[model samples]
Target chain A: MSGIVATIIAKYNYWIYICLMMIGLYAMITKRNLIKKIVGMNIFQTAIILFYVSIGAKRGGTIPIIEHAHGGQSHAVEAVHYINPLPHVLMLTAIVVAVATLGVALALAIRIYNRYRTLEEDEILSRIRGS
Target chain B: MKKLGLLLVILSGALLLYATVDFPLWGDPSSPASLHVSPRYIEKTMEETSVPNIVTAVLADYRGFDTMFETTVIFGAGVVCFLLLRVLGGEEGDHYYRHLPTGVTIHVKGAKGKSLSGEFERIDMLWTPYDLVIKTACRIMIPFIQIYALYVIAHGHHSPGGGFQGGVILGASVILLAISQNLRTALRRIGEKTVGILCAIGVFIYAGTGALCLALGRNFLDYAALASVLGTDPVTARSHGILIVETGVGIAVMATMIWIYNNVSSAGRYDEGL
Candidate 1:
């Protein structure tokens, strides 16, 4: 019990990310409106980005910017001194991709709305089924 | 159906939570993430690229090819939006304008651009109040915003921002203009044609740079090969190449975003866009 408690406490941030992910997942799965589903998808993406960024965090570390000498003397940078930059770089690209996807998705949604005059999934399905 | 969705969500969430047990603790210095090649990037970036910021170095120099494709992706999105929504040829009943100056009503034919002189202002179907506050504020701030965006792109080597963020900011300025003024006013500055050309040119610049390197007997997207052309050493040439590629990315992203906004907001009619 003590080991489990320690594990939970140590990895609490991941647990929070998991909770957020679940909320987003629930919304995406159950939301009827296409736009709502898109929002849920965005939320899910944000959760994943947050999780990746959190993995790079280090206790006593600064940002990824290097502090070097003006006189051209090179100093050894300790790995533990700075936060991991790879995740930040990857997430930057991910964030841009997410925005682009959202724009395209929203545009498609507008097109669908124009065609059917509705955004509800069930209405569209029924309309397709000729019921 | 809802129950099935709920069940699926629960299963996925549980599975993900279970997977979290193997992840490193928050702020663990010796975590796998910190032990890898990122430290080398941080330590060697200044010497290699002479960039003070590691993120910019990694993004522009270390991963230039990835950024090139990302820019292409944004351009593709713009093209997709334009293709989906653009309705060529105006509708006959689309024009019903009443001149505000003299109670004169003219039914404009689908004919393009033959409005009667400055004697008449075509009234809008969806009436909108001319917001002086927003207009004045945006007018005053647009120059500063554009200048800052350029600065951010140029200073990416030393700062927190790079091509993508700067491009978004630049695109936002155009969006702000469209919002504050009417879409017609905004379109005058950046027409649909201009956006298409700019977006294409942006991608071309990126790919062209890579191809240029290949021509110089180096691998594709290798900026270092342009050293002889730039009158600089290979390292400095790489630095300059990164900057140039980043510039291409910024321009591409900015044009694509504006194009997407114009298409989606107006639904390709190019009429009063949001």
Candidate 2:
């Protein structure tokens, strides 16, 4: 029981991300407003970003920037000294993609609003059926 | 429909939580992400490129192709926004401008009145009277923002920023100008055609550099090929190449962001919006 508790405590960050992901999922699934759906999508993207960034962390690691003269000279530096950077790099691109997606989604929403004069999913469907 | 969505959401959430149990501990030094290629990148980055910033080196030099395509994605978003919403040659709606001296309101259809081209546009949009304070602050701040953006781009080798970040910052300054003043002011400084062309040119510069390397009898995107031209050794040539391509990315990101913001916020009308 103590070992199980220790394991859970060690991996608690994953639980945080899981909760966040569930919040986003619930919002995206249950929200009737188109804009709310987009907000949920943004939240989902943020959770993914957080999950990836968290993967790069190290308990005793410094920032990825190497300050001393091991600088350009030697490969003596250890991996445990610096946090993983690949995920950080990948997540940067993911962030840009998220922003672009948000912008495009909002633009599309505006176009729909202009045409249908409503943003609620049920109302839009009803209007479409009536038409 | 809602019931189905709820079912899927709950299933996915449960699956995700179940999967998290198999993951590594938080901030563990022995985690797989840290054990793999990241250590190699950290070890070799400064030695190979002399760039102190590992992320910038990896982003601009090691993963140039990724950054190149990433820049294109933003440019495409800008183009897509314009294509979806642009309505051309439309007249401004009915307007009435107050003559300050005579306190007379001259009503005009399609915003065309006597000497309307210059004077009428001054009152074309509504803004709070206290906007002057915000406008003055923005005017004072824009230059510094632009300078800092350049610094971020130029000093990427030493610091934490690179082309995409600097470009976004640069774009935000133009966006600030538009917000404080008007879209017309921004459109005047950088016309639609210019923005379109500049975005394309930014991508072209990155591709062209890679293509230039190919023409010089090296593999595509092999920056070391331009050693003689840059008057540096192979290692330094790669560093210079990274900087050059990073500049391209910056320009592309900046142009694309401004272009997208202009189109999306205005709904392609270049009319009033926040």
Candidate 3:
């Protein structure tokens, strides 16, 4: 049991991401307000980004920017000395796409609000049924 | 229904947590992700591209196609939002204007007398008194913020920023202006047509760079082909190409962000909104 606890503690980043993902999922699933759902979606994206970035982290490693790189460095750059750049690069695109998604979602919400005059899913549904 | 959702969330959470047992521990250098193509990128980045920042080199050089499409995605989102929300033509609601000298507001019903002469400024229906402190503070800060944004884009090769981050900062500065003043004030500085055109232009710049490489009889986005045009060696040309692409990205991203904000804040009316 102690060994299992230690193992879980060592991989706590993944656990935290899982918790965050669950929270986002709960909000997305249960929230009636459209804006809340969008918030939940954002949280979900954040959790995924955090997960990828955490995977890229290396113990005692520096950022991927090479120091003294411009002045013709003498020493060779070791891969282990730097954190993973691929995930960061991928996540940069993900972050931009996430913002674009958020914008589109909000624009959609605005359109829905313009038409329905309310943002609640249930209210909109009932109104649709009544109409 | 809520209980069902809670149950589903708990089940998924447990499943994900159990799956985490197989994942490498946090910050493990030997993790699978670190062991893959990332190491080669980190080691060879400076040599191949002459860029100090591995992230920028990898993003703009190795994965240039992806970034181009990413810019396209941003542009598409902006276009979609514009289509969904933009309401062109005259606004039908009551128009509000403030007399500058007397500090008194005049409400004009209908679209008959829309234009206002000097000393009478148009305002939003939901307009509160414009805060002098906020306006003055942002006015002082806007120029500096814009300059910093330019720095972020230009210095991306050696630092933690690139076009996307810089572009967003530039867009945010404009957003700051809008929030500080009214939408129309911000719109006057950057008209709607200009923002839309800029959005397309940014993407065009990115795609155009790639096409330029292709025109030089090289593979798409192969910055090595740009050596002749830039009058630099192949390696340095790659670096310069990345900068060009980054600039394109910055412009597109900056314009898209502003475009989205303009449409969303005004709900396509281009008038009074927060």
Candidate 4:
């Protein structure tokens, strides 16, 4: 029981991320409104981004910015003193892609609304069946 | 259906939570992610690119190709929104125009190719009276927001912010303008043609720099090849190259965000919108 508690305490961030992702996924699957699904999708992306960024964190490390990188430093820079930058860099791209994806999805949603005059999935589906 | 969704969500969440046992402890410097190329990037970024922000160096210099494609992706999104939403030169229904002098609204039916004089301003079918406070506040804030965004982009080397965040802020100022006034007022400031061209131009600047490097007998996106052109040593050249690429990214992202907002808010009809 102590071991399990220790493990949970050590890795709680991942647990929270998983919970958030599940919430987002549940909303995406069950929400009838297109806008709600879009919001859910954004939540899912946010969870993943948070996960990646958390993976880059270090206990005693500062941000990825090098001190006196203009090169008048007396002390040599060590990797352990700074947080991992790779995930931050990758997540930056991911964020921009997320924004682009959201834009495209919202545009498509607008087009669908224009066609059916409704944003509810079942309503549009029934209208299609009637037509 | 909702029950099934909940069940599936719980199942996956539990599975993922179980998998967390294999992950490195939170904020562990010895994690596999930190053990690999991240160390090299952190150690060598200063020497190679002379940039304080290792993330910016890795993004613009080390991963230039990826960043280039990211810019292209944003531009493509803008183009896709345009193609999906923009409706051009169609027969719209009745036109509503408000005479400025008398505050009288005139409804013209089937007014195709009809031009109203300066005194009569076009209004949307669903028009709201302009609010003085919102308009004035936004107008005063817009220039400051724009200057801050420019600072974010230009001062990225020593700081946390860079092209993406700054570009979003810049694009948002225009969106704020659109919200405060109307779509037409915002569109008049930066025309549709200018936005479209600027979108392409930004991407072109990014790709053109890579092509320039290629022309100078180096591999694509190798900023060291820009040494002769930039009149700097290879290391400093890399730094300058990152800035140039960042500038391209800023422009592209700014244009794309504006383009997407313009399309979505107006639903492709270049008229009054919230």
Candidate 5:
């Protein structure tokens, strides 16, 4: 059982990330509060960040920095294993995208609140339909 | 309604699940994405561009056209907000205030509100000392924040940053100022007119730089042509060109974001003076 647990831990971070992503999506779809929907969106984006960061990770690898000034031009090197830098870079872009999206979404939410005088998703919907 | 919503959601989830079966596994070393341009980019970018950061090379040079469109997308959002929410000039003296029970007060103080003295005084107590403190802090920080933004823009080439990241930081600084101080004060510091002008100017700086390369007898964004001005090296010229354009993008993005936020938050009621 302990060995099985270790195997699962070693291999299943992706599954956990996927689960969180789905849960967030489910909340966004089913929750009747606008703020909850925003929270769900945050969770979904965070899950994507986790997935990207995980991809960049290499087991027992060091940070992706060349040590000396003379670390010459060779893809093959010794005693300097490093994690992939590409996913980390991609994750940085993703973070900026998420923040921008959040800003726009929140601004819309504020506008909706002003127009309908409520943040409950159902209330806003009914008010719109009534209008 | 709940049942239908749940059922539709479940069906969508099922469809998403089906789609995922064909998707590449997370972090697969053999994935097509890893095999393609990315690996080549990683390997050759430093030698080709003489910039240590591969992401910066990809963003500023290799895929610069995409970055241009990304800025345009932001500009479009700003224009849409402005068109949808702008109150025409000369009717600025028609304003009203409402003090909701939730403690969120709306104060419309301007030429429009000159006739509504009674209503204005009624909500005067709501604009307390705390509001003044927050406003003062925003005033003091705006310049420093903008300078820091410029630093981020300039230093992006050397570090884990770039045009988009620096642009967003600058945008957030302006947004913070707008939120803490009143929108009018923030606008006076960087007005809609200036923002609109700067937004165009920013895009022009980016596109114009690329166009300059074309006129100088090279491909679009071949910064090598600017070698005479920037120094006698293609690397230095490219570095100089990228920094300049990134500053342009940062300015445009920051202004547009603040403009959009102001318009959307005001919800077409600019007479309120935010």
Candidate 6:
């Protein structure tokens, strides 16, 4: 049972992330509320963040920062191995991008609200079609 | 109805699951992404750009053209919003609609002893004491937030920050001001016309800098052309060019975002249809 549990944990982390991602995408696609759609988008973006961060992680790796300057020497001794810093850097930009996209999306939602005075997606569609 | 939808969704999801078999495994060091352009960038970028942050180097130097278009995307969104939702001629009184909240104590400023009638009965409190506190805080924080945003743009070469990150921060601060105060206050501070002009100017600044480099006998975005004026090495010139374009991107993004927010939040108030 313990061996099975370990195997499952090792093999299924990505699957869990994928499941969460699908749930969010499903909500965004099927929900009739604009605000709920935004919430779903947030979840979708957050899952990508999780996927990226998890990729950057290495087993038992230390922080990426270098300690003890080389003091003009060609080579310096170091006891610690550095973790990959690329994904963290990428994630910072991704977070900013996500927020900016969310801002614009929310602004669009507000405009939609003002035009039709309704939050339901189906209602807005029907009204537009009727008009 | 829900169960039917769920079944259809599950069927589609199963199809998607089969598609994932061809994808590279997560964190495979030997994957194509790690093997191709990224490794070259990781090795050569620090020496070429003299910047500690490799991501900034990639964004500002290696793939600067993409950043330019990204800024343009925000500008386009702003233009669309403006066309769709610009408010026209109307006095304050003409647009005001009043309604009372049910089962709540309503406080009237000037109508103390007057009987509740048509206009007075419908008048509810729009600006409350809590709004005042939030407005005051936003006013105090706006300048500092803007300054910090500028710092983030300038220091992006050496640090983890860059144009897009700093631009969004600046835009959010303006949006915060708008939400805490009113649309009028925000417009007064950063008017729509000015934002539109700034958006154009920001794009020009970015594109023009690249053009200048091209005219000076270098590649389109090669910053070595600015070395004569800047009195620095070609490497330093590259960093300076990147910074200039980053500042342009930040300005364009911030102005465009605020403009978009204004238009979207105030839709349908304009009787003059675009």
Encode model 4's per-residue lDDT on A48-123: one tens digit a residue: 9989998999979999998866556546779999999999998888888888999999999999999999999999
What are the lDDT scores of the predictions, listed in order? 0.83, 0.82, 0.91, 0.91, 0.67, 0.68
Ten consecutive residues with minimal summed lDDT in candidate 3 chain A? A67-76
Model 1 lDDT per residue over A37-82, tens place: 9999899899899898998888899988876535477777676787
Ranking by TM-score: 4, 3, 1, 2, 6, 5
Task: Flag clash pairs in model 3.
Answer: none
**Which ranges of candidate 2 are over 4 A from the true structure?**
A1-9, A69-75, B1-3, B92-106, B110-115, B122-130
What value does the lDDT take at residue B191 in candidate 6?
Answer: 79
Per-residue error (Å), model 2, residue B174: 1.0
**What would the per-residue lDDT of candidate 3 be over residues B154-272, giving only the tens digit for each residue?**
99999999898899999999999999987888899998899999999998988998999999999999999999999999999999999999999999999999899999999998885
Tens-digit lDDT track of model 2 for B1-73: 7788878877887898888777888888887888888899888877788776778778877887787787778
Provide backbone clash counts, one per model: 0, 0, 0, 0, 3, 0
Worst 10 residues of 5 chain A by lDDT: A74-83
In model 1, the runs with Cα more than 4 Å from the true position are: A1-9, A68-73, B98-114, B117-123
User: Which of 1 and 4 is the better model by DockQ?
Assistant: 4
| Residue-wise C-alpha lDDT for candidate 6, range B198-243, written one tens digit per residue | 9888878888888998988888878778897789998888878888
> How big is the positional error of residue B40 in model 3, measured in Å on the Cα after superposition?
0.7
lDDT of 3 at B21: 74
Fnat for each predicted structure, in order: 0.73, 0.59, 0.93, 0.89, 0.10, 0.08
Q: For candidate 1, what is the DockQ?
A: 0.70
Clashing pairs in 2: none
TM-score for candidate 5, residues paired by index: 0.75
**Top model by DockQ, which number?**
3
Worst window of 10 by summed lDDT in candidate 6 chain B: B90-99
lDDT of 5 by residue, B179-249 (tens): 78555556777777888888788877888988989998989888888886666688767767778778778
Question: How do the residues B1-274 of candidate 4 rate in per-residue lDDT, one tens digit apiece?
Answer: 9999999999999899888878999899899998988999999988888888999999998998888999999999999999999999885689999999998999999898796999999998899888999999999999999999989988788898888778889999999999999999999999899999989998888899999999999999999999999899999999899888888888888889889999999999988976
Give the per-residue lDDT of model 1 (tens digit) for B1-274: 6798889878987998888778777888888788887888877877787777788888877877777788888988898888888888754444646666676777676636556666665544664756999899999998899999988888787778877878888988998898888777788998889989999998888899999999999999888898989999887888888888888888899999899889888888777777
Model 5 interface RMSD, one decimal? 4.4
